[model samples]
Target: MAPSLDISDWWVKETQKGTPVIVTTKNHNYSVVEINSPNTAFQQVDKDRGKKAKRLDLFACEEEKILNDVEPILLSTKRTLHNSSYNDGDRLLDEDQSWVLNNVFQHHPNKATKMGEKIDYVTVGKHDKYQGTRCFFVISTNSFRADFSYLKCLKNYVKEKYPDGVKAFNQKYFQKRRLKGMNQQQTGMNQQQTQ
Candidate 1:
């Protein structure tokens, strides 16, 4: 039998600030948090679990099973989602997911055509850096358009479904600083107006 978690150990430490520390022992990670009145943090965990259950149901649906033939398409989507640069309050767009999907489909058009399926849209959430985030999606073949449209659609669909957690994390550590460049044409026009 598994040992009960010591919930007190999972409390976010003052030194950790916004980041929660998770300790791994015997292959399991545990978080320490205070269990107090209302337990808003615990409530958030339940909400997340519910959302995950819903996504699993969608994955188990008959129409979605068609994507199984092109499972790699989904893997590729995961890779992209794990590699996106997102910030807090940033809204994920279907187009971003589509870009990754299109790349994957172009590489495996034949398999995609055989499956007759595509990804439609995805939902994602915010996080602090390359950490936990959720993604959800609606999958379909009918809405796919473009060369190898079916495959591209699936790729896009899966990508849009999940949050780009890993990418966001990496961004937090490796942010770049660069000066903004003015458009040459616009600058010239402004100069002329001033003259």
Candidate 2:
């Protein structure tokens, strides 16, 4: 028999070249979005391997801006890469309702797994969950604000994030101005909803 390939094995190696996904275990009736930050990447790494690995998108997309007198490339490591407010960081990504829940899931929360999540607004990538455990995917735009980290940072994001082409993505996924943009279905809704 042919060797079975892990779904994630087919996913792109870097989030920059694809849709840039952030995967987490499926939300429970009482999921805790931790806000007490480690204040540093190392500290964060020590807190939770999965969360830290998931944070690759945060640093790549959220912090991909020039802020606090530091380059977006994260050369200085002097910026407020993490927000103390859980609502601002993870909450913003998960709770905002802007992302699309997908089936393409990625595991290895202990490692930085970067890759484009196909051309969908959001979904669980790689798997229905991680390593036999139930999981979900937060599929947000690879189009991050290019103000934080510029040089050496997100160099591959623009060219590859949208594997299917930006214009097509925008037309297919973007909502109308009437919706004021984004969503807020607190139940961890799955599937992409373009309005």
Candidate 3:
């Protein structure tokens, strides 16, 4: 039987606020931070082990927190790339990663408007790892405002494209938004919301 899903509140909390984060995989004990910078590349720690050892460092302006938290799962599957095993094939990729990435991209804020343009976005790449478990690093562009706006647009775009997208989007957005709003309200942003 397949394993059950483990969804953590930590990942949702960080992503809703658009905060970049550092994710350390428990299985691999590998740590990486998602930042807003282009031109960053994933380093190859070893090349003898095949694709599972390779890591991709990518950049985008959106979903830094969500993406970082879900790295281990996004690339999970049963597919092979060269004659070697990867998260997608050998169960290296965590299932959680797939869930978060799929949900986030599908229902992100304002996703509809930025469907086809060169908007601020997030990009993922892959590399090789040795010694420990496979690892992937995420990067984002330097402009936070642009990235957030683009993500928002993308979310809306998806909603427009798919009839059921908005329903899910609304459910996810409101839950996180309410929590974040409460946190902000305590931090003295309550007055801003009323105005």
Candidate 4:
């Protein structure tokens, strides 16, 4: 029998190209978004407000608290990189390294195991629970951010905590619009009944 290829290595090789790596596992399609270089990701962050920004798209989910508390420096680095105008800053990357290690192996069970010293965002995959489908990937720019540890620490303390994107949007925008729509419907009904 021909030797089976390892999927994780395949994913690493594919993602290094800086393009979305799309693959099918268990009949589900997944698109791994663009992975940026560590240096470039940092540069993008530094170019912006220098970590003073309140929130970043990277920690835009409900899981932000866990990530923010565990590795605040890493969280800030990721947040600043995400807040920058650079189009290549990928927010789809997973926050937990072990999650990627576990899922990738599950999908490619026959593949050989070769562990990397560290896990980054590129190897990370995000699942779509709403759709019940495959996973999307994000690249890790840890090396680049490592250069700015002091800055990350300063930002975390001085700057306000990153806001919860999902909660804020729902409370501020979605809820208001929904209420307006309901009120308009009620007004229309009242007018028709009186007429």
Off by over 4 Å in 1: 1-68, 99-123, 126-133, 136-195
Error of 3 at 75 (Å): 12
Q: What is the lDDT of residue 167 in candidate 2?
A: 39
Give the winner by TM-score: 3
> Please, what is the TM-score per model?
0.20, 0.15, 0.22, 0.17
lDDT of each: 0.41, 0.28, 0.36, 0.37
**Candidate 2: worst 10 consecutive residues by lDDT?**
99-108
Ranking by lDDT: 1, 4, 3, 2
Cand. 4 TM to true fold: 0.17
Q: Candidate 4's residue-wise lDDT over 107-127, tens digit each?
A: 332222222333244321223
Compared with the true structure, what per-residue lDDT tens digits does model 2 show for residues 156-195?
2322444334333233222231132223221223332332
Task: Identify the candidate with maximal lDDT.
Answer: 1
RMSD of each: 19.0, 23.4, 24.1, 26.0
TM-score of model 3 (CA atoms): 0.22
| Per-residue C-alpha lDDT of model 1 across residues 129-160, encoded as one tens digit per residue | 21233332323457532222233344444444
Model 3 lDDT tens row, 142-161? 33321222234334544555
Off by over 4 Å in 4: 1-164
- Sort by TM-score, top down from the best: 3, 1, 4, 2
